[model samples]
Target: MKHQKELYKEAMTVLKATSRTFFIPITFLEKELKTTVGTAYLCMRAIDEIEDDEKLPNTIKAELLHATSQLLLKPFDRNAYLKLLEPYRHQLPEVTLRLSDWLALCPEGIRNTVASSTSEMADGMAKWASKGWHIQTKEDLDEYTYYVAGLVGTMLSDIWLWGAGIKTDRELAIGYGRGLQAVNILRNQSEDKERGVQFIPDGWTRNDLFQYAEENLAKADQYNKSISKRSILMFCKIPLALAHKTLDTMRKGNNKMTRKEVEQTVEEITSE
Candidate 1:
């Protein structure tokens, strides 16, 4: 069995590799909270890799996601999960394959909460993948974002309250998550199209998506302002600032922020 400290180190290494905006802020967290957040992120990222695998058939993706969800819903069963994913080992990433380790990394008291949230995300991803990600209407877009991102906000909020006695408005929390996801959808619109996936509703122009992002971001602003703890506030501020800057950059006909631009934004916010 791996020591707790080793698991934390592994989780942080994976987090640093996988995320551009989240790593520094997550690393800034105090040790226990960092482990919990990092573990939850890897757990969700594990299933997310399955959802985004181009080589996997939609049915297979759905099967894997649903099975992962079911597995998470029960106790962590290393043998059952490894057997379920064995055939697709070549197709899956390390993050997906070592999901059991991530789950085990969560501190025991809040492990179930993290597992339940990740399980819900996996189930939602399965539903969309099974339907070929056919987002046709505003409602469809809302539901999809809620599943993929809004739930993340709720989960993080729950973690905050549990770990630090922090309280936040759940609706605003959902907006914060949805806002970040909208920015990603806007930035990745072309990439998603290349993969035959479209997140924007039919007849919706780029401006419509921009407006959607702006509306949610307004809520995210409120969510950020409501956070009083400096450490947590800084953690929230980094991504929200990046998302806002990304939206502005995208609106100016840029694809996304340059690394320098991202660094500048983080520096500006952290210096404030």
Candidate 2:
């Protein structure tokens, strides 16, 4: 077995390689919180890669996600886990295949939470994959977002309560998660269309999606205000700020923030 230190290092490498947007903000988390959150994020990202892979048949994708969820629930079983994931290893992003390292290093409490959330997310993804990823109504959009992102909010809130002794409103955390996912949906509208996944409700305009995202962002702001610790608040604020900026850019028909804008926003949020 790899030492926890080595596993942690591998997890951090997966985190940085897979999510540059989250990497900087996650650094503001306190030591243990950082490790737990990083592990959780990487695990979720692994499932996400499976869900998002266009080349894989939906049945294969669903099977992989289901297997991953089951692996996370058990004690770390390197041989079994690797064997299960091996067939699709080349199809998934290389960073995502490091799930064993992340799972090996996760603390027990954090591990359980990560397991539960990822299992739930995997089930949701498998269900949606069977549905052909065709999100047709407002309700379907909300459900899909909850599966992919709102659960993340709940997980992070739980982590805050556990590690920082800070309680957050679960509803608001869900809203915060929904808001970020909505922003992503809007930003990736073109790409998702190309990939045959349409998150937009039938009869909804771009403006409608923007409205949905902004309302959720409003709740995200409330989520930030509810955090008592400066470190946690800062940790939450940076991403929320960037999400807001990205939404604004999207509304203006630009799908992204420039590097300079991202740096300025990060500096502004962290300086407060």
Candidate 3:
């Protein structure tokens, strides 16, 4: 658990330093949701690493995924899993290096909480990614994202118990995670399609990505309204703002449009 704190710090540091777009929104959730975000990122990144590893043989990828599923029941398999990532280990120095940076900014107690939580998250993620390629239905997508995103929602609730910072509405917190995952689903629609993965619910399509984006924003309404404190609401506005920006683009822009002019239009809308 102590070591997990170190790993958690490293995860956040890497994300904070190398990722500009993710920095601000994450900061808003810093105290409570920070651990939630860090652990979620590690889990999501593991899936991304496996799926995005173009250099690995397909069988190895499948095997790794399978191993990951086994690991969910035994999280210490992280060391073994990390070993499997040997080929790309050199490229991952920053995941550790950045931890040092984030550690410097963290208070001791919060750091420990972040660490234990993140370690569990990393292990759970490994377990999930091991089966990440098994998406056969929309329900599977929800379960998967719940493993990847909604779990973070529950964690956000846990972190909130640490202080009286926000209204801490559980429904809204759940909404936050769903909305964020919805944003992720929409943004990665093309890439996900290329890989035979679909995170949107049934009856949705690339053609309806924008419509689904609206669904995401609609999903967020409870969360946005759940904030009773204006100050906290203003601070919490970051993720919602990003969700709105993402959904607004989805509404006005054609995700399937590949023409330079059309893509540019989408990009322009997304930029807002």
Candidate 4:
């Protein structure tokens, strides 16, 4: 087995490769807190990659997601995951293939919490994948976002309280997650349509989605205000600021922010 330090180093490498938004804030976290949040983020990203794979059939994705959920329900099992993934190793990304390492990176006390959240997300992804990611109502959209993103908020709240010695409202944390996901849906609407997935409800307009994002972002603002730890506060602020900027950019007819704009936003947030 790799040492925890080695696992954390690899996790950070994967994180930087996969998500600049999270990598920025997570890097500033204190040692153990950094490992805990990094572990959770990588684990979630592992399953997310499986859910978003273009080449895999929905049935195969569902099977992999369901099996992953089942594996996470119990204690960590390297052999079981290896056996489960061996058949489609070539089809999956390295993050998904090396899920056992991410899971093992968590400090033991918080490992189960991270695993359980990831399991729930995987189970949710499996359901949506099996259903062809159908979205025809506001409720349906909410459920889907909750599974994929809102639970992320809940998990982070748990981590904040556990590692940072700060507590926050679980509901507001969920709003933070949903708000970010809604912005993503907005920014990716064209790409998603090209891929035959529609996050917009049947009759909803762009304005409606914007409204949804704004409402949740309001809650996210509240969630950020509730954080007392400066590091955790800054951690939450950078993403929230970026999400707001991205949403505004999309409103102004841009697909997404430029790399320069993203860096400026991060700079502004960190400098404050």
The parts of candidate 2 lying over 4 Å away from their true place are: none
lDDT by residue (13-86, candidate 3, tens digit) is 66776554555556555454565555445444554455456565556655655554444433234466566666
The residue pairs found clashing in candidate 2 are none
**Model 2 error, position 239 (Å):** 1.0
Each prediction's RMSD to truth: 0.9, 1.3, 6.7, 0.9
The whole-model C-alpha lDDT of candidate 2 against the native structure comes to 0.86
- lDDT tens digits by residue: candidate 2, 158-269: 8998888889998999899999999999988999898787889999998999999999999999888888888788889988999999988877878899999999999998
lDDT of 1 by residue, 1-89 (tens): 69978877888888888885789788568888888888888998899899988899999999989988999988989899999999989
Per-model TM values vs. the true structure:
0.98, 0.96, 0.62, 0.98
User: Considering summed lDDT, which 10 consecutive residues are worst modelled in model 2?
Assistant: 95-104
Error of 1 at 225 (Å): 1.7
How many residue pairs collide in each prediction? 0, 0, 4, 0
All candidates' lDDT scores?
A: 0.90, 0.86, 0.54, 0.91
What is candidate 1's CA lDDT for residue 10?
A: 84
Model 3 Cα shift for residue 249 (angstroms): 1.2
Best lDDT among the predictions, by candidate number: 4
Off by over 4 Å in 4: none
lDDT of 4 by residue, 44-147 (tens): 99999999999989999999899999999998788988898888889888788888898888889889999999999999999999989979999999999999
